[model samples]
Target: MKPFKACSCRDPETKKLLGKQCPNISKKGHGGWYARYEAPKSADGKRRQPRIGPFDTERECKAELARVLGTAAQPKAHDERKTTFGEYLERRYAWRRSEAETGEGLKKSTLDAEREAIDLYGKPGLGHIKVVDLTDEHFRELYAAMRKLNRPDEKDDRSEILRRLKEARATRDGRRLHSRPISEGRIRRVHAVLHGALTDAVKLSKIRPDNPTDGVWRSKGGKRKQGRAKPLLWTSERVEAWEKTGTVPAKVMVWTSEQTGAFLDFAEATEERLYPAFHLDAYYGPRRGELVGAEEKDLSLERKRLHILQAQSDDELDDTKTEAGYRQIPLDDESVRVLRAWHKQKLRERLQWGETYRDAGRVFCYEDGSALKAEYLSSRFRILLDRYANIRAKAAEGWPADRIARKFRTTEAAVAAALQRPLPPIRFHDLRHGAATMLLAAGVPIKFVSEILGHASVAFTMDVYAVVADEMAEDATRRIAAFIPRQNRLSAVGASTVPSGG
Candidate 1:
């Protein structure tokens, strides 16, 4: 390692840096002193020469070089100084992927989201900084910068995204990437991932002496923060408003019992192959990943149970997100009947296809026995909703049966027979929410509902479905009032009704 003097002067013709060739390099204030040292070998065994510098004085540069040389005995200490945050993040994700093969790491869906957090936010903001250079102030500034950003949109053009962020940062006025500002909750989650990574750097890898994020305050102030939005049911009023405005009442919405039944009935009437999967979701509340990844062997008709052993994320099979997610859900008689019929249909199709069939042992699949994609559930659900909405509109308009059939390009009988019950729009995941709401409405214990939905805990389930719980409580109050034999119920307790001592 050696300390050297360098200047920012560049060659006029070549447009290259003139390091030691500058005429004024010997002058005291003409150039800055720099330190050059060989870094530890990379994973591929390649040596890297990292230059540290631009110190105003030669003494300072030599001191930095001496410090760097003293740490040569410990390669990790050198790494801590040279490794950028982005580099470490990439390594961590790679490690996680390797560990996942042993069934003890994050699923693809989780890793993808985390990678986005790192790339979209982390890289642009703090990625270039060395791990050792990170501080509470750095993180605080990062949080402030994140709060100023608009929500990212995959569909937005790259130039548009750049312009959006730049304008948002410069003038605090710009077209949004989506409908609203990036939520504080999202920032908090980003902070959490970063904090975890830094903590690992300090404790697990021993790359850093301490985590800089430890001293960083996550939020600005106050005890209040936006929690997860509870699912709201699609009541008649809400449905009307949605039809008029094309917006949901909440981020998460559930269907009323009538709406849920209408959707399922319409699906079955149309001979949708995934009807059984939809039924399972509506009644049992398994996630979309779980529904598609379900194996035929995991179902037990005699035992009336379905085991959630794994899930498909990004079209790849992986373990469930949590231990609670890997559970055995009891099936109702109706579910069993639906599964039996579905099994028979699948068998018939398999026999027809013969050697061409692709049997992956999935309980729900295409006619050729190919596995269903996780996203198909959501997209197909949307298609079904639109079809159902169109049919209902035609029926409501009192169009002649033949005209309505011709409009839909289907038989007049099929068009006329379509159920007209309103199927208010809800996400496929909302089918899971509707299932939980139905369970709560049916007076099933909250604990049982939690287990059915594969929630981490009853409290979490209750917290998420608190709206449904409140509605159920109100209904219970009304039912109890009606059930009790009250003779001329008083609007308020009379003074005479109170005890004499009171």
Candidate 2:
């Protein structure tokens, strides 16, 4: 390492020499101190003198020179291995965010999800582990820690409910009032994020060539598993239990054909502006974001065709979730009629709002013509379901259907039909599931359903809705059996010919 030296210049005010015989000082530029050193040789076998900086004083320059030389003296493997997992994750997030902003990277929604996973699971669990030291075991431990981290405990204070109550009293803003345990799906997401970051690290040569997260176990052995739970259809028994206990089975639930029709009848009869959107989801299986992101120009009501070009991702409108998501769907006569009615309704609302209306060109919008938010749509759908349930309960108690219909501003027929079958509690996304199930039940080809649903492949569709496929198989067997005759006419014809028996 080079020794410290001061610049050889006289102080302007004092008119005196700044230093005496400073050998390491450079007379170039502004006569500031600098350090000269030898860098590692290339494959051709030649040395080069690398210069440091125009530091204020020789002491500062010398300190920097020492650090540079010390780093060079270490093995090449250790030179690029200084960053920890936490630090690399932050850098990776920044890079990904920049890519998303420039429109050449991951979608904003994807980046946000990655950021969340890093903050919630990555940083808290494996932040301190150095990139060089990261191993499959580290990721395994991280999964275990995340699983145990936010588990609800009996002794924990349920302060969120109290906070929500206070907020309700002070202001009528409704937010979630409680927390739930971190799901296996979320943990798997974190694992995916970590795996991606470390894979990049390997490519950048910041860590070992092999990725540590490649085959890490997400759960303990022997039946403990990690992945998204398959969606469960709400049966009659489940609906009854839900009515009594106010609890629904499975995070993702699908309604039967009758229940779906009931919901649609209620929405349409009540003149819900979003009825068209919900109807499209049930019949065509477009994602919630896609339905909200739809625009007037993308629809061809006369031709009975609708184009899906984009989807809402948080506050930004972005490309579809996957390349396959950008597709054209053939609309049935009913879908076209509903869409045309909705278009006319939107025009009326726009005229009422006049110059104050914000025409963002979205098919679904608020009364003010502003774009509809996905979360708002979901929340409103839940409210409508609750109202539907109440109306059904009243109808069960012998309340006059016409009176109930008048009270709710819907038709008496709609009320009667909605009460005919028990409504299954389902989320907004479940409408997509119901659509797929209905199509499969009707014997639509799985490939066609995959395309309509914008799934990457038919195998994926079959995997997700395996239960539906099983039921379809049984139906196919029964239909085949119905075509076969127990008595053979061919045998009787052959028996009449005596030569045939010989």
How many residue pairs clash in all the candidates, one count each?
Answer: 0, 0
Report the lDDT tens digits of candidate 1 across residue range 101-197.
Answer: 6778877777887887787667667778887667788788777666555544423534433433444334235434344566778787788889988
The lDDT values for all models are 0.78, 0.75
Taking all chains together, each candidate's TM-score versus the true structure is 0.72, 0.69
Candidate 2 matches the true fold with a TM-score of 0.69
Which residue pairs come into collision in candidate 2? none
Model 2, global lDDT: 0.75
- For model 1, the local distance difference test gives 0.78
Candidate 1 Cα errors over 4 Å, as ranges: 1-75, 119-121, 135-189, 215-224, 396-398, 409-419, 469-502
Candidate 2 wrongly placed segments (more than 4 Å)? 1-82, 128-130, 133-141, 154-178, 207-215, 220-252, 395-414, 466-502
